[model samples]
Target: MHGSSSRIVGGDLASVMTREGDKVSLICQTDGKPDPTLTWTKENRNLSNPKQGRKHTHLLTLVREEDAGEYRCRAENPHGSANKTFRLVVQSTPNHMGTMVPLLVGLFLLKVFFCFLLILATFWFSNRQKKAPVMREDTTRG
Candidate 1:
């Protein structure tokens, strides 16, 4: 009969944080007495991987906010199943925001300046179009 046992290879608790749009890999390993079959899952759903072994690495490229979750690696045999959980956190990259703020401010100022010039131009044109008081010259005995 086949039996199994599980032990985390690297650390007791596994966790990683990476910026969005970046690639990350989470490595999970288990030492099994009988060398149980291993599978990886996230949010209780099995994850499809082309490679399977004692040490499995989940590769995520161009990570997004939705990719953040808890991943579970299960090692199972006829005797029983053992599992370990790891956390993956995806964070927004601050570099984009840091550069965006200044660009937005510059655009806003340009808009304001253009609008002020438009109003000034409109006022000048309206006053110019108005006819000045007609000048009258009267030559007569007073």
Candidate 2:
């Protein structure tokens, strides 16, 4: 009698997204008459010992930008072998507050500059009005 052929039962082969310095896990569940041997690789390079025993969970801790790439998980037994592929995308966290602070300060300074210009213009108009000479009527009728 022949044992059941090894087959991939459950796992996620979809592209995954994560941030730098974060942790992630990829699971690869398999079913067979005899327990299948699991293996993992990144960018076609072997990961050595990436699997967590029979749980088939590959843990990535303190993930970095360099870690973003194609990952593959394979399971093999005497009968046959099966595999799955995954894509990891790493993004850097943006500092919104830091960027907004400078923008806000620039806007405030622009407002102050416009207000100063308005005050100068009002003062100049008032001085010009005061400096105007009053018309005087002729002393004797022609």
- Best-performing candidate as measured by TM-score: 1
Question: lDDT values of the candidates?
Answer: 0.77, 0.83
Per-model TM-score versus the true fold:
0.64, 0.62
Which segments of candidate 2 are over 4 A away from where they belong? 50-54, 95-142
Estimate the overall C-alpha local distance difference test score of candidate 2. Answer: 0.83
Q: Write the per-residue lDDT of candidate 2 for residues 1-142, one digit (tens) a residue.
A: 6677667776547688999999999877888767788899998889866432344877999988999999888888778888888799999778799999999999999999999999999999999999999899998998
Q: Tens-digit lDDT track for model 1 on 1-142? A: 5555655576656788888999988777767666667778899988965333577777889999999999877766555666677888888877787899999999999999999999999999888878566678776756
Residue 83, model 1: Cα distance from true site in angstroms: 1.7
Taking the candidates one at a time, how many backbone clashes does each contain? 0, 0
Worst 10 residues of 2 by lDDT: 48-57
Which candidate tops lDDT?
Answer: 2
